[model samples]
Target: MERIQEALAKARAQRQQGSATRTEHAAPPKINPSVDDAWGALSPFKLNRALLKSHRVVAAETGRDAAPYDLLRTKIIHQAQMNNWRRVAIVSPDMGAGKSTTVANLAFSFERQRDMRVLCIDLDLRRPSLHKVLGQKSDHSMSDVLNGHVRFSEHGLRLGERVAFGLNNGPAPNPSELLLSQAARDTLEGIEQDYAPNLTLFDISPLNASDDNIAFLQNVDCAIIIAAAETTPIKRIDQAERQVAELTNVMGIVLNKCRYISDNDGYDYY
Candidate 1:
């Protein structure tokens, strides 16, 4: 527990530094009134409430199960809006840490905000579980879109007027190389320019899995590391936090799947 607290403190210090740097050089964002129109053009799909609940995406629910994620959504939005951060990557120390579920719930939570536009992308090309979690199978591969072979509009899907998703059906070949390439950066830039989402959440590979997350972290403005309680080791969380802080702003660490929270402790649920 001491190690975890240390990691959190380091992350907070890194976030403060990143915020200062961005504030020093950040320019005012351009107002794009057509952003809503762009989002509206995407094909809309209905969310399966039952399927989402089964997959642990309960942020859309009005119950206590949704409280933690709603608070997470609020914190993320506050930090992003304050620091002019638009791209955020969600990663974990290792697989099975609930990274994908967190991304989906955040998307749903962001969707409830009528004025916020969100783009959820599955950048975990090695496994790509986000699509399954969202209960939507994509006909298009996100890797193809990143490689410039397909346009985002052709490969993306929308929910209502605010949320868009870029999902993948299968794993990509040489995902690390692809993420490190110039094409991937260009593709992301184009997407942000065209879609104009208030926030873009990337469900990327775990930190200890491979170089894929490290390669792709350069493209995002900030990241949050999700660690599973009673499962993820404190040393792993510390290492992952350090790696992310070196690459981008460390927003904070999320302790997921906790089973032992006191009745009075609501803020530490996630």
Candidate 2:
């Protein structure tokens, strides 16, 4: 813990010293109605319970399977509220670490909060899969919105009144360049300005995969690294942690797909 803290402090110091002035842009075009009104206007979609269950998006269930995600939601909300962070990136050291699963569950968990408005954007352009995990398809992908081919209002889908998703239909070409472009920044800023979600979760590519995650990390206020318990190495986690801390605040690490459960951990009642 101490080592992690030290690394975070060092990285933050470096970030502060090297931070560059942000490019100024003209005021973004606003939606006709207010932010809340625009959010309410999003197209609603019905979720398939069985499909969600098969994908292990247990946070939508009423059973004990949802408990862990609820706890994660509480912790994330607390930390984000404390720090005034709205945009959060969910990243991993490599592919197949359940980062997309975590993003889905976490978004559903936030849905349980009546007052919370959440936006989940699938930014994993090279291998987009969040839509499949959620069992939904979109006519316009996030890439289209980022490239100004489609407006977010036209592309985003609403799940209930509280959650909205910016999904991808297929793999996008030249993902890194797209993510780092000024158009990307402008589009993201416009979404935040118009949607005004309490939390905007971006499911990005793995840290070790390419420069895509690095390019997009600059737009987020903080990030959470997801690691597969037995598959993700400690060194990779450390390296990813250091890299994220250098770019933005490190909320914490989440360990997924663990098989062992201690008897004394106190969930037997469930």
Candidate 3:
């Protein structure tokens, strides 16, 4: 914790010492919408080294294959900065479309930004995998927070002080109902108010799989739709876009899992 604090302090100092023009893209003043006492209690825990490797997520480092994530991250950040969008949801047209993987990788990619703070909340209740993807394990989950059993910030896994996560744990029989409830909205708002992250990402269930994704989308500022190459149906993608467009801005689409044979330079996202 001490080390992380020092690193953050040093980074901030460097940011402050930069040329005067650096503040040109400064974030908008806060409205302080969700501030609460729970914000101060979030714990810091180290991610599992082996687990990160298995998921191909390295928070601070950008490898060749992760290049696409870096590109996506830059574009999203530019848009978020321009629009003052703090919360963004990642969803796909259907299951097995690699939305979870895209969300996880994007979170890590955003975490790499020295001046940015990111929070990733896994809302894919029926098939929660963000915690596993981040190689995190905990007694507290989003369910506990929603059930009023725990504070929203109490059990987060940290990637330095800048990156934190509130992951879903067990399947909920009534996932859509839970997401639409005021309790769920309050929990997410509480986390945002507390952490004051530059970006908040919700890893949601596939659009056609259940009502969960659509319900969750209502709370976020914008969304990204990830489509699997050759695997996802065009009709479903169109339907998902129509649904999300009515709720929030469709930031852009990410095409994943296309056949990429290794070449002289590196692998391509295509």
Candidate 4:
């Protein structure tokens, strides 16, 4: 009986030690909340103005014959044609390439122009600038959700009657890690289930600067590569196309900031 008690005591001790070890090893995940930095970067009217300008450029170049804003609406409807792909990643070759502006306007156009349910996720963890483009004050972001600092619903903001997803900036770990995390996948799945939108746009980081964009590409059904007019070299566009093709289901390219001199602008859309 004494030997039996000793064996049971030893087993209890082992269990206690295991519990202690687990408790000691487990720590709450850390996150960086760059809310002030994100909100401080914008004025309310700045994004609206940019959207208006881009819309005008597209309208004039395409010979849409409608108001620029109306033309923008038409373009967004065209973007949602990807099969089983509610999420679309918008990317560019490099910075100052007008991707953020294009994505914000595209999201806006999706909601206002088509009356479709849309969620615009700003997955550009490195140098995230979507908040400024959307004129939203994001208290929590994608980073927060990934690390358990917040929930996905908590980080979402509604701007101009459309949904915008933002992520907080923190110590720059490999941004791809977060994008490929299970949390991101589940969050996207929830988005697909809850809204079941005609389109969901993910404004990802520039491909040349970071690989974060690639992490979400395979998960999303398609990608849209943006090229600026007169500036984006052919090689750069090719590289963007190749990169997206390698990682994602490539939809096609959208030539932004193109001149209105050509008659083939609108008709070229396939």
For residue 131, what is the lDDT in candidate 1? 87
- Model 2, range 1-270, lDDT digits (tens) per residue? 565355446545644653442112112223345876887788886689899999988888765788888888999889887777777899999999999999999888888888777889999999999999999988878999999999999988898878899999999989988987889988888787788677889999998777787677766778999999879999999999988977887999998987655597645221
Global Cα RMSD, each model: 5.8, 5.7, 12.2, 15.0
Q: After superposition, how far is residue 159 of candidate 2 from its true place, in Å?
A: 1.0
In candidate 1, clashing pairs total 0
- Superpose all Cα atoms of candidate 3 onto the true structure and report the RMSD in Å to 1 decimal: 12.2
* Candidate 1 residue spans exceeding 4 A from truth: 1-33, 265-270
What C-alpha lDDT does candidate 1 achieve relative to the native structure? 0.82
What is the C-alpha local distance difference test score of each model?
0.82, 0.82, 0.72, 0.59
**CA shift at 80, candidate 1, in angstroms?**
1.4
lDDT score for residue 201 of model 2? 92
For model 1, residues 123-205, the per-residue Cα lDDT tens digits are 99999999899888777889999988899988889977778999999999999889878788778877887887778899999
Candidate 1 TM-score, true structure as reference: 0.86
| Model 3, span 78-173: residue lDDT tens | 998887777788998888887777777777787678777787888898988877776667786787777678876567767654667888666766
**Which stretches of model 3 miss by more than 4 angstroms?**
1-41, 58-60, 260-267
Cα shift from native, residue 33, model 1 (Å): 5.0
Off by over 4 Å in 4: 1-79, 160-164, 167-172, 261-270
- What are the clash counts of all predictions, listed in order? 0, 0, 0, 1
